[model samples]
Target: MREDTAQEQGLDLEPPVPMEEEKEVMEEMEVEIEDPLPCLSETDTQGIIKGRDLFGYVGIEAVLDQMRRKTMKAGFEFNIMVVGQSGLGKSTLVNTLFKSKVSRKSCTPNYEEKISKTVHLQSVSHIIEEKGVKMKLTVIDTPGFGDQINNENCWEPIVKYVNEQYEKYLKEELNVNRKRRIPDSRVHCCVYFLPATGHWLRPIDVEFMRRLGKIVSIVPVIAKADTLTLEERLEFKQRIRQDLQANGIRVYPQKEYDEDAEDRILNDKIRENIPFAVVGTDKEHQVNGNKVLGRKTKWGIIEVENVAHCEFAHLRDLLIRSHLQDLKDVTHNIHYETYRVKRLNESNANGLALSPLTLENGTLEKSEAESHL
Candidate 1:
């Protein structure tokens, strides 16, 4: 058996290899190979370096300009009020803009299983100026209309507060304790938050906004925007723009408008009645002993719940660019010029010391304010 096996297990039998196989082996061995060079050429390497440099320069310039502005502008505070319907996520928006997560802490009761602790959120109206802009931003988050159990008819009370306080501030001189009082001559703006997913404008929203418009520049904030389909959201925005325009209410212009936007607006019936979404705690459940139903899912809490993502950012940007910008310009003028002239005139009328500049015919002499500043 050892002799018979073709050079058996350990034996070498090497005589009958085919010529074709040998030729194939030789050809494979003869194949040429090329070595790889660097992946990037000189030109490409330079381009990458140039782009990085350019980006660095732009970033550096932005930081420097911000620093310069901070140094030059003192903390100029402007008070703003935010009002909206209950459950429209006004609290969420406030928490987002101020980056404080105040609402989350307040809402922790809903998540807690231990001992069933309840956390009620307080009404917050705090200053949130960007550190660079320091004390410039003072945001007032007002409680929603009809939110309190006892204060169901709260409109008159809020209006009274606004009007009375504004008048008093205008009359009084700047005192240490009264610094919170912004003068009537001050430029103040209001932000009115609404659900972006629902009908363009509810009757209550419009009526309240119209009244607010008379008082200050009111921005119609489209709140809780993430839950809406893209087309529905765009249509909603267009409807709002058209309605506000028709009502003689000024809205900010968009970057671009589709020519067919007008046609789309006329077709949508935004005026159709919608049921109110009652949002409240169980303790405040029955006002006057009547249970209030919550918002329906079709156009309900989900729409308002997503507000943390969309509405707050949009509202923040709109306020900063439109209302806050105007407020800053006006505040600067008042602090530097208008207040000086008005105070001097009032003092002189009260038989106080006369300054170098004379006052005549209810107006200060030329360059009086500039000289005083």
Candidate 2:
């Protein structure tokens, strides 16, 4: 066919391109190819390709020692609050709690100093050190708690004090450049001193614990337990536990907070022995020809540290021994975390927490939260 007729009839009369031109055209073609996956060296037991495990130790376990040394140098904070009415041996118990923890090998006698009643809040701190480990122990005591005839809202001051400490910690946390270790003045535990009433929990006791249980860890104790007989004490404890459960009061080692099976088992034992009947005494009496910490009674000597005589040892063990650090953890992780979430939510609700952090030149605008925090 003629070239003109071939073009109209869809027939090619032109010669093909050269091999070099064809190769150039093929190379110039912008074809998108799907990317192949990376190669896997080995699979773990779970079929995951993480890196190969090295033989021998890398001394990563030394981080624990490093943390220990760092913490030993930095020290730590333990804040406790003792809440109850006067004449419950709150002062004596506080002394006993601290004194028993000290090393007797090089320790001097603990001088008896009267803890005067304050109409308001009072916090006392002492740096306790043992075996190169230092702890800043602060004890908060209220003198006029339930001292008024019409003790209405007596928990206001105590609640205010606890929240204030949390606020201080939160403020430090919210700072643009916070310290490596913020001073933790937050109350780790509140030892609620309940009078040795042979009967059930009183209205004052119920009210106080009901309000305070939400914000802090409360470890209720039966003060002057030496007065109650063993049977009476057991009955009273059962009643108090019932009242606590009925009122929805949360105490230390609460069931919902069991981290694991071991924790649950241990805390279950403590829960069974809740509201430990405790007796405190600074004076020592001669018992069995040996000087021991006990109250000199006309009938016989009531040993303060003796588990048979009272639950003071149990209370002490729970507070200063096994559950001490756990108390602080619960305060920080659970109670303080709850407060923090609510406060953050409130700040957002109040338009204080801005989206994208509403910053200008890395400066925050003044708000009510700034002052409160």
Candidate 3:
């Protein structure tokens, strides 16, 4: 009767398949539903693939070429700070490094006449280009840093300046409509000049580097190293290294920051020769039938680029050729990140509102300022 009623309602019923056949059909459907590609679980270790493992050619290596072209077109910025007394040849050394009039002394020519009685921060920037690669190099010169009779807290201005740059960058990052590439003014490397006293670090030197080293990459160098004998230079460098360790000061290419075995090995060599004894000169003289940058004296001309004469070449290579990008990276990643976290934490603790002043300046608005904390 039910089958007759179903037929009257236009319903059709088929015989059920045997259990074994139904099971086989179900298994086939399950096979079709399975994924072809492999998937990783949460705890699965990722396999490393080498070039030899690849079956077909993929243009992955071309990414490096793309990055190189992009970097060449976009250019970059590097801000370096020179800290020392007035007559430490800081400006001269900078000019010699870049082989250009990029220092305050070269720009002003009479910068000595305008030396301030107190520690003053002066920045001079120049757009330098070579081989189609441009760099906006800014040299921050600290005049009268340790010149005063009672030079107390001479590093205050410098420390404040570094933190200020970090703060400026932080504000821009907090803005809703932040720039695609915010202008980088933060000091990347600080070339701290230590006097060639042939003695241990002085109280001022210890204090200044101790504070600044925590905030920036401090590359302490023996200024006017030509004044010291070879023996004196060695002994002085040893003493300074000991002092640095005793005072717990952190300098550039720090061991703790090394990323891998290769970096550690390279930086280990640099650490062994810390506080590079350097002589700076912009004058060129005839040497071995070739003109060379050197300092002329009654005894002989001290070739600046000659490694035997001074460690200036090593310093130049470090600051320019090899570790220039590393300096910028450390400044942005480590130093700036440390400052950013601390500032954000402070804001969270104090419940500080985003300042209207910052909003008025169009950096951050109250409604758009998101709590990074």
lDDT of each model, Cα atoms only? Answer: 0.47, 0.79, 0.86
Q: Write the per-residue lDDT of candidate 3 for residues 136-238, one digit (tens) a residue.
A: 9999998878888998767777777787788788878888898999999999999999999998899999988888887899999999999999999999999
How many pairs in model 3 have backbone atoms within 3 A of each other, for residues 3 or more apart or on separate chains, i.e. clashes? 0
Ten consecutive residues with minimal summed lDDT in candidate 1?
Answer: 273-282
Candidate 2 shows a clash count of 0
Candidate 3, residue 44: CA error in Å? Answer: 3.3
> Candidate 3, which ten residues in sequence have the lowest lDDT sum?
364-373
Candidate 3, residue 154: lDDT: 71
Residue range 9-56, candidate 2, lDDT tens digits: 998766979999999989889696643433443552443323354446
Q: Where does model 2 exceed 4 Å of error?
A: 1-54, 100-119, 353-373
TM-score of each: 0.45, 0.76, 0.85
Q: What is the alpha-carbon lDDT of model 2 when measured against the actual structure?
A: 0.79
Candidate 1: residue 245 lDDT (0-100) = 60
Cα lDDT of candidate 3 equals 0.86
Ranking by TM-score: 3, 2, 1
Cα shift from native, residue 14, model 2 (Å): 32
Clashing pairs in 1: none
Choose 1 or 3, whichever is better by lDDT.
3
